[model samples]
Target chain A: MTTMRTETSTGAEEVRPKSALEPLISAENVSYHASGRQILQDISLTVARGETVTVVGPNGAGKTTLLRVLLGLISPTSGRVTSKPHLRIGYLPQKIHIDPVLPLSVNRIMTLTGSFTQEQIQAALEETGVSHLNGQSVFNLSGGEFQRMMLARALLRNPELLVLDEPVQGVDYLGEAELYELIANIRKKYSCSVLMISHDLHVVMSSTDRVICIDQHVCCQGKPQYVCNHTEFQRLFGRQFSESLSVYSHDHDHRHDISGNIQEKNQ
Target chain B: MTLLDDFLWRAIFAGLGIAIVAGPLGCFVVWRRMAYLGDTMSHSSLLGIAMGFLLQINLILAVFVVAALVAILLFLLQRQKQLAADAILGTLAHASLALGVLAISLMTWIRVDLMSFLFGDILSVEISDLYLIYGSGLIVLLVMLKIWKPLLAITANEELARAEGIPSVPLQLIFMLLIALIIALAMKIVGVLLVTALLIIPATAARRFSKTPEQMAVIAVLIGVASVFIGLFTSLEFDTPSGPSIVISIVLFFFLSFILPAPKTYVLR
Candidate 1:
């Protein structure tokens, strides 16, 4: 069960009562439970303007659910979720998205994403470096190509915020690097916010403005350098903390063994 | 040629209108795997026709009321969250059809041409049907054009459409309402028993050949009009049912589409 009532404010959304600069998205005490067990609890977070926040956690840490709630796709069970009114948003879900029966070319996909002139479509495609795949069928795109295609679609919106889920999972190094540089360039070019989900924190930590560490819920959050050395993270995730050394969030301060369950990774 | 020309011209206009509307809507049905769902709505129009006869109401108006009511009921039942969507649609369809049969059974005082509605008397359709088909066809086709971008946006992903300011829910309802009207009006010529066949076959045939949705819709309309004419001619020569004749022509087109290689679109299922 959930409740959503509008709060009063100067602008459209009552959530922005304090000031217009008070973050576009605010989720307070959001909890999720399914099958009589809690999957997430007490998650509070805010996404400020032009900030790219990456949320990293072990599998099933409710990362996707959080994204869903943030995008207004899902209702949180026990908390308030609000966003700026008329906020333009673009989203790319993980997995290859192809409506096999939808007879559409890459150009058609861009057209349906939002209304755009042909020149804008071409420029968006060129910017994302997918101009060659313009007339190509989306169903036949490779992982890297599909990722770029989604970026182009999002770029067509000229959104205020972009939410991408697991974009680099299946791509190789060049593809990953290309996507990273594209996001950086897009940020500088458009000044839009990005909330991306990534397991490879090494790639994302340096790029994003903030890092949100989430386990069952938000474990801790701060600049990447701050959360990496927190003691609570070391205590809660025991061995996962050790094995995830390649992650930008672990430390070498394990002078004593708290648990024998620790697995070592190349630090 | 004047007498023959009138029939041919009317058939062309009527068939063209139905094809354009049904082609794209049928794509939605196929993509959503709503085969049985389409069948249910078509059958419900039968009960609507029956109710019209019992109430001494205009047959088309009766159809509008009954089909709209059933469409609304089925949509509501689908929201139950307990029953599978198809099951809800199935129960409503079978029940309404059975009620229509029983209503016809008890009404011996008044007579109704049930076969005309069931099997569709396209060969005998009045001039008013031509106007009705074309008028509704224009409205549906134009509305489909105006809403085409946003409709695809909604159908592709409801949440995504909403977030993108598509107003997905109300627009989806409006689309469903147009589909109800098309199914109701098309029933006069295509008949209820096999109307879904006419709606789906051409779209499927076109899907096998086209690379984009807009192209697929256009090709589907062309296929539908061609199938109708071929079926009419074949039925005239062999003295067979016009609906089945149209369906068979579509099947031939389907087979030809398969034999002649085109880009694969996963249409087997």
Candidate 2:
């Protein structure tokens, strides 16, 4: 069972309160049971306008399930999710298998919603650095290229909220940083709230406004720095993992793994 | 040339009209990997034929009604978590075929050539059959053209289409009804056994050369028309069965596509 309510704006005080504005999206203690297994526990999070939130967790931790619940693609077994009325959400799924028999060009996929003009489609592709691939078959795109194409398609709606399951899943390490940076720029450019799932700790540390470390439920969520230093995060990811991320965060030039010290790839 | 002068011209017109509708609808069947679903619908159409014979109703109307009923049943069954789609389809396909064959056997009032229902008698197509083909074919084509974008969106990615506020359930139901309607119309051109081939093969052949979905649909229609012409000519010259002959023509075109540079591809199912 789920319920959603929209309240009228209360009287304003002399000083404007940030809380007065409704959140762009929020889930309230949502729990989901699927296939007779509990995929998600009581989980709650909120995304305000213009905030970039990243969810990080070990695999099989119901991150995708949580995203689907938040997206209203599936209903939770208990609790509810609320959002601003008539909110437009753009979703970039983890992986979409476009049938090879169906011939779809990059430009064609962007206008799938039928709301974009040719110029708008071209501009969105250009914005994502995939303008050259406008006429290329969607099936012919490489993983990184397809990810960018999906981003371009998602941006066509001019969504107030963008939800990406894994924005840079198959991208190379360098491409990963560049894509995250591109996402940050897109957030600033569109001024839309960005929600994504990621495994790149170093990239997420610098890119997101808030990092929610979830394993079945919210382990901890706050500033990336705070979450990185939290005991729960350390236990889940390990002390060594957070230390390496911290080192990478500070140096910004060298790469390091959880078990090893900094190693300069260029030098 | 008089309108009913030769049966060959009537056969050509009937076959071509069926192709006009089957081509685009077949492309969706191929794109969505619903070939088995097509087979299931066509197979169950035989049950509709049997019931029509028993009740002395219009054969075309009976086939349409039964096919639509099976589609609705499949839709409801798919909602239930117990059975996989293929399992349900397999049961329905064979059960409907057995029941249809049994029902046909039980009727002794009129001698029915079972082979004619299994493999079509395109050579004996009446002028009235042409009217049914063209009239219903036009409606299917227009409705398909209207729903093409949303249908393609749902076929490509149901979640994405739903996210974009596309009415997926209604679109899917409409798509199923279109397939049922086509299957009913196509029974005379290609019997229940060969109807799926008419829908899938030309579409597969068109995929080799197409660069866009609209291009694919158009090319598929051309391939379908060409197959009908070739198959009918082959039937005349070689004394082969017309329904199977058309499917063979389509298969030959699929093989002919080997000359094109092979694209790196994967089958959905």
Candidate 3:
């Protein structure tokens, strides 16, 4: 399940910042280069109401860079980004590391907002079915538990736009299935737009409505089903993509696409 | 008490005042893992000290101004098109320290027991320095209390904090300002090299004894206070330098905490 396309380079300079367009996100003529490497190119992109955008590309294709820009963590070399007001944003990072000696636990992490009451923390842990871990040290949490803990944290924020960077990394088969199910349920309950970086094509493909193939450029953008059948998806990524063989977990030179390509090209 | 005793009490008051203010802000430095950063800034304060002597201005204000400028320079260098934040901190630390030492050497009038100032003898504190320490520290601590929540948010994740509408740039400036204040006062008590121990070791020892970050911050103060007492006594008995004596006491506590068999689990809400 993959969507492919050609035309990998495009500049997004013409984007306007009109706040009334019902566009959750608009990136116009954005370009970014990190460590003398071209991570993101001049690209125009937009996400609208009820849109779930999946960014996919080979390893180092600037998927992370685009996400950083969306999160306002990194400034683009050139380009203007505009977003709707107070866009209840929730983000799940690639991984959470607490240094073990930091004295942070599951409950502490879940209560990160600090604006939340104890009852809210209890409710989030209950919803994520991770109440048992409330007392556990974060260092002892398994990969799946850690992921669910992070999700529970995001839920505490009550965000309308959920952004996750590779939520299903290093998880067991049952855990992965449970994760996807949990996401579907969250979307249904909250009716929030979901933007996540994932490499598991077999799992995310059928579920994603919008697919944007980014390979240091805008390769293609359309509905997931259309992308799965597109000739462009076939040329760049020909694999049928088994569920067991995921991205970036292997020891060899692995390439990752959170459905964002990880392609490294010097700008 | 005689007039000399009044002066002694004033110096001690200055010491206590600085400890109170630095206790909380120092915890943040430890939380952000910026202990070495505190040392770097404290070292930069020497440049300000030298400038104060050369320019014939108030030493405290000069130290604050110069160290704060160094902090701003650090922030700008961090945003450099090519340099990383860590690299900028490294270069500023060394360059500023050397310039400070060189500037100090140029002043012949600065012959007043330089070793005590360097190693924290605390015998020369004036009434004005006491007032300065308490007043500035109180204001800084009050500001810190007001912004504590947002500060914690930034410490967790900078980008995430900004996305949630927290102004990280301004917050970073405030953080650096508090750090500069700490450097200005702590430089006298800790010497530039030893100030980081006050920020890091207390927090490090506190981590084993507390559950949440807030609790750790509080415990760090207590731990720091304990080390101060131990150090003060040891220095009096052995006639050793107070700065190094305090650091040694801090290290001793750390070792003791590590060697003692800790509980299997601790519950912190």
Candidate 4:
């Protein structure tokens, strides 16, 4: 495989042609077993620098388990995951339930994991288009607003790799498209590699460089168009469904503010 | 007689010290929804007292050791997943208390003030108890300040904290130990039965006024201090039980908090 390159120990073997771009994260034959049930089996994938890879799978397909293993939140039962040394990863979890009893402001949530300057917090919030929510209580936030707040918090880390687990959950259709666009913008702005999980098969982000479709194990992996046409993907998600799948390319000239009101682009 | 020699003064000092440490830790308890775990630890503390008398060791040391062991046992049992979390807590909580009562009753040779251990006799606190409360309370507060950020991160979301490279497992273990330590220390002032009341009520009352976690913690401490002062003075005036009076005072503040307008930004669930 083009993605798999063995490390050369001796100086004599170093003459072999090396790929110009190295992978930021690579997993080899990774399998995870929990409670005597195999959740993942012999999964292999690589995320190279500045690449956006999306993992789409059905419900209970161990998509979350794969993300947790890659993030090292949980270890694989077999095989291994390798990442570049000192790699900074910003992870946005599926959902964070903040109990109402604990009064937390958006500002406090930004600094939950580490201390950040006020300017840094503002900049991150502005980038995510949630600057007005800085001092508001987290309990008062709408679903889409909360997701943006979480995304902004993740960006404060200045991560080399941004990992998201089901980023569009609990969002409306329009909000989902807006969030996907925001993510694509972030990837370009920060020049960070993106790894995300999505359960929706009908729509995949068009900016995604690679699509890995998995059900307990990898069914098919390639560019979005190739994966949709693969027989393995068609079998997992019926041929009729696969044929209807569309890449969500952002072609709109207007953008919505936090209030969902449309505004024309200056250009 | 000097203030240090006065029993009432010693009691007040000890109560204030406990309140100071309990406030911040209680915010964590309320946030993480571990009030039941607190109940489990304190209820098992009676067994710690029983073991102390039997082994002829320092009561506080015995209680700390026993509470820590129970916390660890509960941790291991949770991993087994044989029973639901509350079910396991309920079983351990009552079983330990029953064993403590049985063991204490079986020992006919010693004269134990069972009511005092159950209900607490804070008015009779000695100066040495003040030293222990202040010294341990200081350590608890310092350790809490050190782990404040990461602990909040874990409380907000454990998986996210782990992904951010915070060592959540070890931090949780340390948090459990801290809870055990506080329960052991406060048992002398609030007794085993009402210990959790002091840990949770002030925090609950402080929740309405806070806009941030740190603000909640500080306000909780202030409210705890107010409760201790009000409870001690009222008990002195009315000749009531000191421990229960303090808890009653805390409850009064909790109810009074509801009457006042909540912070403007707070969103009711």
lDDT of 4 by residue, B233-264 (tens): 88889988888988999999999999999866
- Index of the highest-DockQ prediction: 4
Residues A9-75 of candidate 2 have per-residue lDDT tens digits of 3445424544524488898898989878899999999988889999999999899999888877788
Candidate 3 docking band:
acceptable
Worst 10 residues of 4 chain A by lDDT: A1-10
Pairs that collide, model 1: A103-B212, A103-B213
lDDT, residue B50, candidate 1: 75
Position B46, candidate 2: lDDT = 80
User: Which 10-residue window of candidate 1 chain A scores lowest in summed lDDT?
Assistant: A1-10
For candidate 3, write residues B1-269 as lDDT tens digits: 35526644554455566666666787778778787677678778778888888898977788889889888877777776687667777888899989988888888877645566566765556666766777888888898998887877777766666666677788889989888887787667767677767777877877777667777777777766677777766777787787788778878878877786655687322
Question: How many steric overlaps are in each model, in order?
Answer: 2, 0, 24, 0
lDDT value for model 4? 0.85
lDDT of 2 by residue, B1-269 (tens): 49656888988998899888888999999998899999999999889999999889978889999999999999889887878999999999999999988888888886887787788887657877788888988999999989998999998898888878888889889989999988888888778799999999888998878777888888889999999999999998998888999999989989987776755542222
Position A74, candidate 1: lDDT: 61
TM-score-based ranking: 4, 2, 3, 1
Least accurate 10 contiguous residues by lDDT in model 4 chain B: B119-128
Residue range with the least summed lDDT across 10 consecutive positions in model 2 chain B: B260-269
Query: For every candidate, how close is chain A to the native chain A in TM-score?
Result: 0.83, 0.85, 0.80, 0.84
Better of 2 and 4 by TM-score: 4
